[model samples]
Target: MSTTDCIITSSVVPDELRLNVLPCYLGRHYLTGESMVYDWAARLCSSYEGGHWNFFTLSNGGFYMAPSNMDRVHVRWYMNGYSDMMGADAFGITVTLFALCHLAEHTLDDVIVTRYHQLREFAVHHAEAANILRAID
Candidate 1:
């Protein structure tokens, strides 16, 4: 197995806000000797990228307009290494986006809502993958 560690990073409004969201799935797979992490990470990353773009478009720049407190909250939450940390981050982002859309007198159309659902699905998939990997370990 490879000795390289996995580095999962996330990008937000500002470059300085970038964070390592989680350990690399490759490293996790190597450590756990389980294939699920690789499979799930591929799936989750694809879904996450798509959802991110969809929400980004809907924000019309409002997403980045969040207050300093919100940004700080996100940065701190993302630093944790647990898998559920991703889920919380996902939920928090979704909620913040929806709230911002409403506060801006904008409606979250079906597309945006669908993207949130996609993110939720991806989170569940990741959770299942983690559970399976844990079981095998």
Candidate 2:
């Protein structure tokens, strides 16, 4: 990808929404002063199937799966199977977004309860981000 094929904005989400797609801002720092990406990863891991998400960090890139599927989980072509940084980050966001949308659908059907506030928050944020991205597109 060329340098120009990227987006460099003051906002991570489409607009300036802090709690947009992600549970928290990706660019912020936690109380430990570490990047919020770590916390985001943790939250994503905890988002579905009672925190059975398995996140593996390989030398190339990382991939995650819910319900601890060993045979079903493998690195993608982009993971080398892609980049150690970009690939992992991309897959992490994809997984989080997928979980959020999937749960949101079931929640709408009243199949899933909002017992976990994190899941509800993620669904709401992802919805808001999707609407903003759609408008931008």
Candidate 3:
């Protein structure tokens, strides 16, 4: 595994006016292992550029299970060598707040809103699916 394998970033508006938003990206095989940052986030935010797939979506409900015969992409909430604060769980949330302070100069308002909705909808669907599957088992 790479050293920096998990990273999260956020975009905050009205810096002083915090909102109840949880913008996060959970990159499994999606993220490169060497850095604590995901391949997609690094590419999107222009942080990392060693990936073949540049366009990745954070709106796929966050949970990605490996299809039959495919390589496993673990849902990593934290790395073994990292501290609690540096964990994906903690970083994901923290990056959201920290990102707010540093807004992308070119990021559109509509785009941000749309992405937020996507994240929310996916979260709901993913949760329901998990519950249904759990009940079935």
Candidate 4:
């Protein structure tokens, strides 16, 4: 695959996100950051029964974890009423973007705006960008 056809991954979730995203955003627990994302995703993703999942994050700050199966976890959810099969990677990133979008709509918090842009920039280049944008639209 070419450079434009790949997504960066981490063998495990980054520890830093426990403080920035997991606790307040994904869940209230610190240590269960990984599980929190998985559990929340369970609402839509059909399964995590696949092999070990890999984590994806941006250089600035964000977290998305997806199983190794090319099928990934099929997610059937969307904020805009558009729904279809989207990999867990794309689904997770899309939800995070939506959450950030809603939060930013209220006030112009620099931190929130920065994170929104960071993840948006990352998502636009991601291999699953099409799925993500489809869900968002």
Q: Which predicted model would earn the best lDDT?
A: 4
> Clashes in model 4: which pairs?
none
- Look at candidate 1 and give me any clashing residue pairs: 6-24
lDDT (Cα atoms) of all candidates against the true structure? 0.29, 0.30, 0.27, 0.58
lDDT (Cα, tens digit) per residue for candidate 1, span 31-55: 2212222233333233332122111
Which stretches of model 2 miss by more than 4 angstroms? Answer: 1-86, 109-137
Model 3, stretches more than 4 Å misplaced? 1-50, 54-70, 79-110, 126-137
Q: Model 1, residue 119: displacement in angstroms?
A: 1.2
Best model per TM-score: 4
Kindly report which residue stretches of model 4 are placed more than 4 angstroms away from their true locations once superposed: 1-56, 61-81
TM-scores, one per candidate: 0.23, 0.23, 0.24, 0.55
Our tally of clashes for model 1 stands at: 1
Q: Per-residue lDDT tens digits of candidate 2, residues 1-137? A: 85334332221222344233222311122122122223434443332223323332221121122233222222222322221222332334344434434443544523122312232233233323443222112
- Candidates 1 and 4 compared: the better one by lDDT is 4
Q: Which of 1 and 4 is the better model by TM-score? A: 4
Candidate 1 similarity to native, TM-score: 0.23
Model 3, 1-137: lDDT tens digits are 44123232222223232221223332231122112233323322322223321112342322111112212122222322221212222222222222321222224344334444443333333323332222112
Clashes of 4: 0
Better of 3 and 4 by lDDT: 4
Number of backbone collisions per candidate, in order?
1, 4, 11, 0
